[model samples]
Target: MNHDSYDDNYIRGILNGVKSIAMVGASPVNVRPSYFAFKYLAQRGYDMIPVNPGHVGKSLLGKPFVASLSDIGRPVDMIDIFRNSSHIMPVVDEALTLSPLPKVIWMQLGARDDAAAERAEAAGLKVVMNRCPKIEYGRLSSEISWMGVNSRTLSSKRAPIPTQGMRLSLNRTSVGGGATTASDRAAKNRSEPT
Candidate 1:
């Protein structure tokens, strides 16, 4: 449970387990890392809820943005923090107020708060600090290796690429809860008027 270093299995477990994620500090600007991460995770099948006070009532990736974590009506398996290190404590405080309480607290790259992490862990939430879920997912699933990026996973056989192209398929069986598969969601999106 060290905040400084996390095992691959621990990171993989979180990326695989969470079905729905409430992304705090999500941005509407495409240039921001949060925006890219939000889009990437959504495309991969996880139901992503955007939580940003300024963008409340706006839509991101087809999902309405909420003012806070409590505004989300359903249970969120993970709360991905994209805020500054100094802001993490309040974010963690807000996450703890949820009814079911998120299963995990993930702090994005360059965002770290040992004190906040400790508080979240003490409250029984699995904590992953200073790691980006998008990066971890790509690395663990071998999707990045296909992009000629070093995913750091070694294997003789290449991971199967989706016939549709570079789009990665969601591991529906590995997804926790009864969340809808990414394929199904993509199909729905396509069938919609857009």
Candidate 2:
């Protein structure tokens, strides 16, 4: 099926079922989007393995940081990439080699490599590019407030906050940004034609 056919509901289902995720390029700095995204996922009860060579042997959000996907020595439901386009291939390659293979390879916003994504898709893995799983989750599940400005107002005389920010806005209600929000990431499990 075409990429456009894989809608928010489908992605959300996948996210809901995933129990663990390998966060490639996860950073120790809390200010980084990846760090917060990983933290958010962890808070939501998903096991998050931080993958960063420099931070190997350390931990983020209490999960050990591995140098690579294989270093995790266990099955990972997904590989959530936070690296740049230029650095994504190796991660995809490694993810492809995993025994069970990852159910999904999610490229964070501003990070897309057509070749790498094609490889993953060709290997029978679900691939999402340039979309934040977190944003979609919030919108599809009504976890975040998306009521836009109208004659009605939540507070007296104040305008509604437009769902715009570091996250890419989809459908005027769903906002995706930074490393993709936890809610958006959870949206990755929706079942549709892939």
Candidate 3:
């Protein structure tokens, strides 16, 4: 598959299908993009695991941070990398060693390694480079458009809800693998400042 320009369907599929994600190079600081991404994905229903050597045994959003992917001790459906381009290959190598290899290897924005991507794809894993899943999710789900961000998808009709009683559905269950009940949305609304 060409990594240069990915079709919307391919990105949507990965974001929809994956259940759990192990975020390599995650940071504890809230201001960092990775940290914001971690919080956002978790809010959107994906089980976001943080993997960072410095914060091993610590917690992020109530999920324990592991030193490495191998330390996760379970199958991770995807690996979202936040490291520099030059460091991607070793992370790919480590991802390959997992018992149930992740279905996808996603390199964060500004991070790309063609050789590593080729290697992972050769091993049968779907690869995405220089993209952020959180951004893709918001784009595909029309969240960005709703926020007036000019998502670039023009349609006369409002985007259809993926399911009944759901306003934005990206194919994953709400935050905890459950529907985004009215109360949940209400609480989120209350928490955000006016």
Write model 2 residue lDDT over 44-129, tens digit each, in one string. Answer: 56777899999877888778888989888989999999998799999999998899888999998767677898899899988877
The top-ranked prediction according to TM-score is 1
Give me the runs in candidate 3 sitting further than 4 Å from their true place.
Answer: 154-167, 171-194
- How many collisions between residues are there in candidate 1? 0
lDDT over C-alpha atoms for residue 176 of model 3: 28
Instruction: Output the better candidate (1/2) by lDDT.
Output: 1
Worst-scoring 10-residue span by lDDT in model 1: 170-179
Q: Using lDDT, give the best candidate's number.
A: 3
- Report per-prediction Cα RMSD to one decimal: 12.1, 10.0, 11.5
Model 3 global lDDT (CA atoms, 0 to 1): 0.81
Model 1 residue 151 lDDT score: 57
Q: Which stretches in model 2 have alpha-carbon errors above 4 Å? A: 1-6, 146-194
lDDT of 1 at 76: 95
Which pairs clash inside model 1?
none
